[model samples]
Target: MEFFPYDVKELFKQIESKPNLWNRSAHEYRNKEAREHDWKAIYTHFEPNFDKMNRLDQKEIGECIMTKWNYIRASFMRTVKHGPPTRRPYVYYDHLKFLLKSDVKAIDAPHLDNNDDTLEQIPEKKLKVSPFLDEDTEIF
Candidate 1:
């Protein structure tokens, strides 16, 4: 199923309105039953005409939404959160800013220990050359 840009934007709005769906620390986020209930509610809201008779259909709907959600999240992380100054912000960056309200850091700094002596103590191993690649070796 194809989702229009408007639908996706509205979907993000829906998720934003419900903290349990987006907030990682929410108790409902970790609760399987609560999470499934929320997804069922979301599915009904977006798919009023469809009937969720089988578990597969519900799972498929959830997967589709998750794929889109992940894409939006990854784009926000790359463009707005970690992008260069010249890079343009993602279209939904403002809509999803609530996601960053928690302890989410924009950029993760690399952990570096400035110990030069430790590097010098390690010896490099010599690699054995493959006999098949050598011009002096013949294949039987």
Candidate 2:
């Protein structure tokens, strides 16, 4: 669970070298094309925008990377705790980067408050339900 700060950078380099680490059938079919497209999009999105991002935004992205790095490390720990896979190296670093980048936007989300709740409180609806419910009903 202890992720070094450079882990993400190392992962990016590894992913660039070995883009098809997962080796799914879908990857065999389309990964080359898809990976190119994904890389292009990532570059387009991040390259020019890098300088525009504030220090806070960069910090948020770093936090996201750390969070996902720890999560993947924890998963690896669990995998080892249970048993080794028939194959070695069950997860790839790119998988962790993918997870981190996917969630990075949420970490960088702006804290603007919409005016919906400024004037008045929205009424809460009360649902009538029996405290003791048999196994038939689902709460959700």
Candidate 3:
């Protein structure tokens, strides 16, 4: 069985232990979700104009896109490597961010190297041809 962080369980237990605490905690948790949703709405304000953006702005947009792409890729890697989470407060998102920020370059470097090696391994072949050969050649 998977285990949750001790503090998370402790907080849940505390809320369950008292009726007033349970009510307050439930309200606070729901409000926290609402706040996060509002914050996400604010992120939309930074929308970039692809055509008008300068090189640096484009680069920044590219980096953000790459970061999110890497996060998704790393999440899959984590699920494959560590198995699925079984409890609340799973650290998958945090782990994804960490891998995107730190491990992505190293993880992708090997794949790039392998691609180069594969290309290099293919043998170069040359076919011989007559420079002045006509369209038709007479043969008995």
TM-scores for all candidates? 0.61, 0.28, 0.28
Give candidate 1's TM-score. Answer: 0.61
RMSD of each candidate relative to the true structure: 12.2, 17.0, 21.1
lDDT preference between candidates 2 and 3, better one: 2
lDDT of 2 by residue, 60-108 (tens): 6545554664565566444433444554644553344343322222222
Clashes of each: 0, 0, 0
Superior candidate under TM-score, 1 versus 3: 1
Q: Model 1, residue 33: displacement in angstroms?
A: 1.4
Best by TM-score: 1
Task: List model 1 lDDT by residue over 11-81, tens digit each.
Answer: 87777777787777786777878776776677777877436457787677767877787787777756644
lDDT accuracy of residue 36 in candidate 3: 42
User: Residue 58 CA error for candidate 1 (Å)?
Assistant: 3.1
lDDT by residue for model 3 over 39-63, one digit each (tens)? 3332232342554767787566545
Worst 10 residues of 3 by lDDT: 110-119
Score candidate 1 by lDDT.
Answer: 0.62
